[model samples]
Target: MLQAFESAAFAAWPAQQSLDLLGWHLRLDRGYTKRANSANATAQSLPLTASDVQAIENHFRRSGLTPTFRLTSFAPIEDSDRLLDACGYRACDESLVMTRSLAGFVDGSEIAFAPDAAAWLDAFAHASGKRGADQAVHLEILRRITAPCAWAVHASDGPSPACGLGVLVGDQLGLFDVATHRDHQRRGLARMLCGGLLGWGARRGAQTAFLQVVAANSPAIRLYESLGFEIAYRYWYRVPTT
Candidate 1:
């Protein structure tokens, strides 16, 4: 199940470039998000040796990116993690992969679905406060998605208060970029937007839903838990000290 989510996530949030090396997926996207730019383990059967690590690091360096690794429970990478630690890699940004069955999922209020990717990016920028170069990078990632997706936003008389993305791969739905404007938070906008996204996925035959969030985000974790989501697994990144 963990591996399944990993695959779905890769497709849902794709990188600009990817290469398979020694059971690790080396991804790069102008050093944006770690998930897109880090080396992620995909197979346990292939041994991850110190030389392989050097090769991976060299590849990232050649691409002008910091060598980073996303170690997850999806694959048996305990040895790899230990090797990275020994090599002065600092572990950080622990996150949870939450999931729930959408057998009886319910949605609230009529949330607007963006007519197109460009419109969705505009609303997301307003709600997320991410613009300029970041907006272009995000748009590229969104455009690269081949799976069915829904860009949901909740707006009132003024600018949008919340925006999110839902990507469906087979029977699974992966939620990403769920954000509410700082000024409009605590007004239940995120919950409503998430519910609407889930509904959009459920209606399209998605039987399961998954989302990733930083473990330290108590409020966000609580909100997901309230919606029947549970922590299915944990993942963290390893980056060089210098």
Candidate 2:
């Protein structure tokens, strides 16, 4: 199940460039989010060696980005983690992938749906307070998604205080980029928006919903738990010693 979600996530949050080498998926996206810029093991049986790790590092260096690896709990990468540790790689930004069944879920909020990718990007930027290059790259990623997607906002009549993204891969709905404006914190905007996205997915025949959140974000974790999501797996990034 984790592997299936891994594939869906790579598709849902695609990078600008992707290369498959030695049973690993290497991605690059202008040094943006780690998920889009890190090397990830594609299978459990990959025979990754220290030399392969060095080659991966050299590839990223040539691209002007730091070489990073996303190590998942389920992907036993032939002691690659040990090799990275030996090479002075530090682990950080551990995150949890939470999932829930959409069966019998209910959401009745009058949530607003963005008409297009650009509109959704605008709402997301406003809610997330992200501008300039972040928004530009995010828009490109959003536009690249070919799966059925939903871009939702808290309100339709005016500027949205909260926004979210949902990408439906087969029967699973992958939630991403859920954000609420700083001024609107503690008002349940995120909850409502997420509920709305889940409801949309359910209506579209989605059977499961999943989302990724930083493990250190206690408040967000609590909110996701309240929404019936449970930790399905954990993944973290390994960065070179600096």
- The TM-score of predicted model 2 comes to 0.94
Runs in model 2 deviating more than 4 A are: 45-47
Candidate 1 TM-score over all chains jointly: 0.95
Weakest 10 consecutive residues of candidate 2 by summed lDDT: 41-50
Quantify all predictions' global Cα lDDT against the true fold. 0.89, 0.89
lDDT of 1 at 180: 92
lDDT of 1: 0.89
Inter-residue clash pairs, candidate 2: none
Q: Write down the lDDT that model 2 would get.
A: 0.89
Residues 106-171, candidate 2: write the lDDT tens digits.
899778888999999898888889888777777788898999998888874678889999999999
Q: In model 1, how large is the Cα lDDT of residue 93? A: 98
lDDT of 1 by residue, 106-160 (tens): 7765888888888889888899898887777778888899999888888667777
